[model samples]
Each structure stands twice: as structure tokens, then as C-alpha cells.
Target: MPDDPLPTHAGPFALGTFRAGRAPFPGLVTGARVRDLSDLVPSVRALVEDWDSRLPRLTALAARTDGTWHDLPDLDVLAPIEPGQILQSGANYRKHVVDLVAAEKESLHGATPEDARADAERMMDERIRSGVPYVFLGSPRAMCGPYDDIVLPALGEQHDWELELALVIGKAGRNIAEADAYDHVAAYTVCNDLTTRDRLYRPDLKAIGTDWFTAKNADTFLPTGPFLVPAAFVGDPGDLRITLRHNGIVRQDESTKDMIFDIPRLIAYVSTTTTLRPGDLLLTGSPAGNGAHWGVFLKPGDLIEAEITGLGQQRNTVRSSQA
Candidate 1:
């Protein structure tokens, strides 16, 4: 018999889901090993169901999560949970949106890049005072493991990466106020919301810009979760650094402090529109510096590594499916 396991004190444990043969199972990640939770929990959904209550038990179990010990790298770490509702925020970063607006103004109105940038910066300030955040829905099926290979679809040649800080909802509620928004958070994770740049807007329907489905719903587009760090451990969501590299070249490098709308406001706004349930994911938005900013795009065999402060890292290689 194995020696008795030690008891745990107060914990800020991180949890994740792993593949058990062909099925997915939840596990506790501690040190260099993962304590399998196959017998105790059915899925990550069980843990998210009532995170406030379940967290204590999970922390305790982390002391002696003795089902089967597996080396972290040897197991297949997958997205933590398959939430039906994935709410994604867009244009929430000041520098990013300003850059985009400036580019558009210069291209369409023939303004100097300097003038356009100034006007866009002014527009951002106006919006901050009066406008609301742009929120969109993403398909759960688009989600893939952080370390898994991201297969670039053949339909579009300009596939891009948008690394973001994502929040996992724990408490279920509707019309949650901004003051109480932080209470609804369970954990924080990193996500790369991949996009197809060519299909972003339809020329046929110029008035109705942005085909989110065509641009974002490709299989394996959203690379997520090597680990889900507990919310308590994450001091402030907006202070985290978001960084991404393409083929070892630094691309996106910015902090969440540039966000026009912080997590509390985003959560409050989203909750007012629809009920936010446990297990749902809310992406705060990508910061400045994307492929669009650098005039480059993802190609076949390109490796992308996206990381956010404390949430863990996502390393994915892009594969072209055209051939």
C-alpha cells in the first residue's frame, strides 16, 4: 500500500481537464504531477456547478488526490470546460481599436496616418464617456487545447491570432451589478481567439460589417487552457500582461490595463443583457499589437505561443488544411 497522503492547508490550487483514453477528465495540477479526479468527478462541469462550495473540497483533495499519478506533459491537457455560451468582447482595448480606426480612416478618407491616429484617439475618449462595449458570441466547438495543433482552414489565407484574458463564471445570476461583478468569477485562463482576416467583412453587405461566424468559428480556432488559476490568486484581471509570438517573433505585447472596459463593467454589461451561468467564459478582449497591426498573417507550419500573466501558457502550431 502507498504511504498515507498529507493533509493540505489553505490552498490557491489550479485545476484543469485531461484526456483519459478517449474521454476527458478533471485533475488537480500541483508540482510536476497531475492528480487524476476520474472517480470523484464526472467532468469539469461538476466542479463549476457550485464552485464556491466545491472549491474547498477540491483544495482538500489536492493534498491527497490519489487516483493515479501522471506526468503533466505525458497527459493530454484539454480546454478546462465545454461551456455552451462563450461571450467574447471586441474593441475593448483603447490602443488596439484606435490603431484599427486610424488605419481605416487613412485608407478610406485619405487622411495622413498621424492625423487619423489623433482623431481615432479622440474618438476612443468620446466612446469611453458615452459608448458601450462590443460583445460577440463564439462557438464552444471552436475551442481547442492550449498545446494542441491549430489547423488553419483552407477557406481563408489571412488567419490571425488574438490573445486574451478569459474569465470563468462560477456563480449564476442575472443583472449583476458592476460593484458585485468580481464575486461571480471562479478562475482565470488564457485564450487565443483566432480570426480569418479576409472574411471579417462582406462586400455584398457593406452596411452589415463583420461576419463573426465566418471569421471566428473555424475548428480549433480558439486555443485555451493549459491551466485555470483560481480567481483569488489572480490579484487584478486588468493588470495582467498579454503576449503572443509567431514563429519566435514577438507580435502582440501589451497589458490588460489598456482595456476601455474593465472586467467589472464587462461582466455587468453582459449580465444585464443575458443571464451568466457557471462554466460560461467571458473574454475581456485582446490588447494592442495583432497580425493586422504588423501587416503579417499566419501561415502553415507557424508556431504560436500565447501567454498571460499567471494564467499559464498556450503553445500551438498552425497547420494548413488546403492541401
Candidate 2:
């Protein structure tokens, strides 16, 4: 007896279908449908509002049927969107910072010159220095759709995996205040921020810790999707659980509540420094259990799956790279 908006039929995940050619293909969410960027932004805004108002009903509908009840087409089967930009935060988790500090101490052997310089630079970056949110951009060319294979770069032996909850900006805004940060968000998606630890830790790399752009932004480094759960479906971005599995073994198990800086703070902080545009993605920092910290790196043929409560899960397989 829930009063949620019921779909006409069950499907794999509630997806937003866009008009492509003569037919509409499932692209974003279920029940709600849109065409492209022009259609998506405005519709997403309205959808979040609707979801906020009809939470009881929507929750009932989402809970009434498991996603598996419907025959979901292969997630990889959906056409892809050219996202405007992918922005991510670093050291936003207090525990992560503690771990990084410990690692630096151990690796530098009493603060090497390079380590000192890197720490100094970190203290200056807006995203890292302010004790507020720090943001970095990922190359659009690095994006891969859900279920795509993530290639393990042969150049590095210490690869790592981070499971992060990512927000898709729905509205364009500059200098947005923390009080109104949620208004700019369109939807939520799960992302695995894969990394090459050796490249990042290498002493010869000038950028070293300062250069997540290369260490984390390599090809296929950002694996996103399953479905962009419209913000309506997810009531509060900060009240959710994030879990990561490697080859069916749990690796990262934590919650967004553990974030040292929450979503609203992140949005307000980043927007004050840069214009956040529609299709721009913000990956809130990852929780503690990363593979590199645990000494277990991904190898070819390994499977990685990341999931967030309410939002769907993203799965990827590790492929051997010839390079």
C-alpha cells in the first residue's frame, strides 16, 4: 500500500531513456526518460524535487521489485555520453590522510627532500591545503561505460583501487554556496577510482603525489555506471554505504557518513573555486579499505565490483595490457 510512482513494467534498473534515432534507448533511469544534455539537466532537477516530495511512494516502488526482476539489457549495451568533465577529491577522508602521512614517513625515511616538497605543495592546493575539499580533473578520454574492461598498466606493479560515490551535476553554477549545493546535483553513480601506485610513488616523477591527474586519470581508470540513479532516488548523498569487492572478496566496506567533508561542503567548496557545469562529475573521496594499503593489487582476470546503497553497482574485469 505504498503510494510511490509505479512503473508500467519492471526493468533491469530503473533507467532514463533518451530519444535516439527513431527509438528511445534506456540510458539513464527507469520510468523517467530524457533525450540529451538539453533534456537531462532540467528533467533531473524536476525529478529530484519530485523524489523529495514523494519519498514514501518512490521508496516503496524501488523496494517492491528487485532490479533482477526485469530483464535488464547488458549495461555495456547502452550508448555512451561524452561527459563534460570528471572531478574528484583527495585526502578528504581523515583516515586516508593519516594513512598517507604514515606512508610518507615510511617511504621517505625521515622526510626526504622530495617528500617535504610534495607535502608543501599539498598544503597549498585548494583541494588539499584548506582542510576543505580539493578537486582534480580526469580526462574525458579516460571514461569507460559500465562493465567495460579495466586494463592493468604493465608499467606499474602496485596498482590500487578506490570505491567512491560520484555525483553528476545537473545545473551549471559558479560560486555556489554550501547551503544550496544540493540544488546543483542531478544524480548519483558509483565509480572505482583505479590507481597505479608505483607511478604515483616513484621518486623520479616530478609531480609525484601532486599528480593524481596522471596516476589516477590513465585510460580506463574511471569505471562508472550501471545506471545514473537520479538524485530523487537517493534522498541524502551522505547517508549511504559504499562497498568494494575484488575477485568476490570484500576489500573496502565503509559509509559516506565517514567522509571528513560531506557532499554539501564539497559542492560549495569546489564551486567557489571553479564553475561547476552540467555533466560535470564530482567523486567524493573514498573510504579506508584501498587495495594498496592492504598490499593486494589487482591482476589480470580479476573482477572488481563497487556498490552504494540505493544507487546501483558498477562491475569491471581486469585485462592484461600489452604495453
Candidate 3:
């Protein structure tokens, strides 16, 4: 059986900071390190045109199972790239959002059962009106590498975690077709879309319709790393499992199969609006089990672990910035 044809064509590697004499901090890892394509554009293009012939080598180097992995300690894990832009979508799961609203009502003001139901309905209606794929932008400065401590803003108290799968753009393209969208992808990674819920819901209560920017774009809010698994290794980006654990407690558990706007569709949709360039990043949205609705915010000394099936895991400790 031709070696089972290799479950995936490429990787199962870790993204980390390489230093002179320390362990590479596993920042993020995905089934495929497609993001590298952006860093090596010509090579990726060549391979894409002839994947059957070139995939094997890429897979071999990525696998690197010789147990001789080097330890480089002096390096600091930083954002994978200084991406040209970062785009994120919301409400991609109906059930998740429904559960979110219900949980929110129960935590806020101790609302009655009838009020909770009413609040959930209103929240869903608002989310729908915001659009099927609610989108937001995160500042590049907000990006951080795995193991880097996240500093919560002093003004914010409702800090939350949103575990998600992120896409790294391989080639620069505009008005890309859904059929060709995957071709533009270089790799995938895990993203923790950290936010401040109080600020996010503030405008909602005021009926002013805020854009969710303040809630998301805080310093070091986006923690991404471990490794960038090449695209050839990931046969289907939408079928993998994603899970999040806070201090060893499973909080979010679901499969990418639940995404309303699949990877291909999301790439195409974003391309129609803006040109996606090499090194650009798109966060495919988080599933339902985020900390915002659960009244579970990260406190000092807390650790978070985000993982995707086949992709490696990201572990980080949370610390507060003292005044």
C-alpha cells in the first residue's frame, strides 16, 4: 500500500523562536505549515503548479522525526510575521452565538428566565444584522508569539479568550475566486483572539453599534505560534478539530466542520473586498466556547493552551502589567 500515501502530504511541525542554546518555544503549529509559502513565494508557486512531484520533500523536512531537533534558547518568540493586515470574522456559528447570548444574560444582572430568552433572541438578531460574516481588523502591534505573556489593559476587566484557526496568505492576489482561494494559502496556525468583553458589549447596550475594535485590538492580544505547517500537509482545513483549555480545564471543544463560512469561502469573500497579499493573515473566527460568555476571565498566573488536530499546541502564561 505505497506507505499509506502519507496521511498528509506535508508536516506536523512546531513554530517557535530559535535561539543559540535554548529549546525552540513552540508558538503555533498546524497540520500544514502553509505560511512558509509567503516567506518563500517562488518555491511555493513552483510546488503548487506541480504538487504531486514536489510535496514529498517538503513533508520530509517538516516531519524531522530524527529526535535530533536543536535547542536554541536565546531567541524570543515573536509574531510569525509583521503581516500587512489581519482580518477576523464573527458569528460564524449560530449555535455557539445562541449559547453565548444565553450565558451572557445569565451572568449579567441576574436576569429572569424570560429575560434571558428575550436577550438571546435580540443578540442573535443583532449578530445577523451585522452580517452573516461579521468582520474586524486587529492592529499588527497586537500580535505576539507563543509563550509571550499577554498584558491586559488596566482599563479592561472583562478580558476573554477566543481560540481560532488562522490562515497565512501565500501569494498576493485580488478578487480571487473560491475555486482558486486555497491556492493562495501558504499555511494555517492557531490564534487566540483575546478581547475585553465589557468594551465589546458597551456599545451594544448603548445602541451605538461599535465595530468591536476596542474589544479585540489590545497589545499582545493575538498569540500565534508553534509552527506553520505547509499547505500540502493539510488536505482539508475545515475538517480538523480545535480545542482550548484554560489551566488544564477543557473550555472550548469542537471541529472546524462547524464553520459557517468555510476556509475557501472566507478567502474569496475577503479577496473581493481587499487584496490579500503574501504575509497577510486571516483569523477564521472562533467556536462557541470562548471565555467571554462563561464569566471566566484569565487572572494573573493563568495559563492557556490552544490546539488544533494534527497541528501542534500553543501554551502561554498570563500576567498583569502593574501600574
Q: Please report the candidate that would top TM-score against the real structure.
A: 1
Candidate 3 residue-wise lDDT, 1-323, digit = tens = 01111112134543333232343222222232222332332432244334344446555655544322432232344455556789998877655876766767788868876788777777666755554566777888888876678888787788899888888787778988889998888777778989887777564467766547788888878887544566666668888888889999998998888776778778878888898887678898888877865769988888887788755567777888772
Please identify model 3 stretches exceeding 4 Å from their true place. 1-17, 21-69, 72-76, 101-131, 201-208
Structure candidate 1, residue pairs in collision: none
Residue range 186-234, candidate 1, lDDT tens digits: 9888899999999999999999998999999999999888777889888
TM-score of 3: 0.74
lDDT of 1 at 151: 91
TM-score of each: 0.93, 0.73, 0.74
Q: Considering lDDT, where higher is better, how would the candidates rank from best to worst?
A: 1, 3, 2
Q: Residue 172 in model 1: shift from native, Å?
A: 0.8
Task: Give per-residue CA lDDT, model 2, range 1-323, as digits (tens).
Answer: 01223222123234433333454343334443322323233433334344434334444545444332222342222213446777888777655665676567657768765675566446434444356666787786777755678887667777789888888787788988878888887677777888888777547756644556657877888777655666765777777888899999898888787777888888888887788877787889898888877889988888887788876666778888872
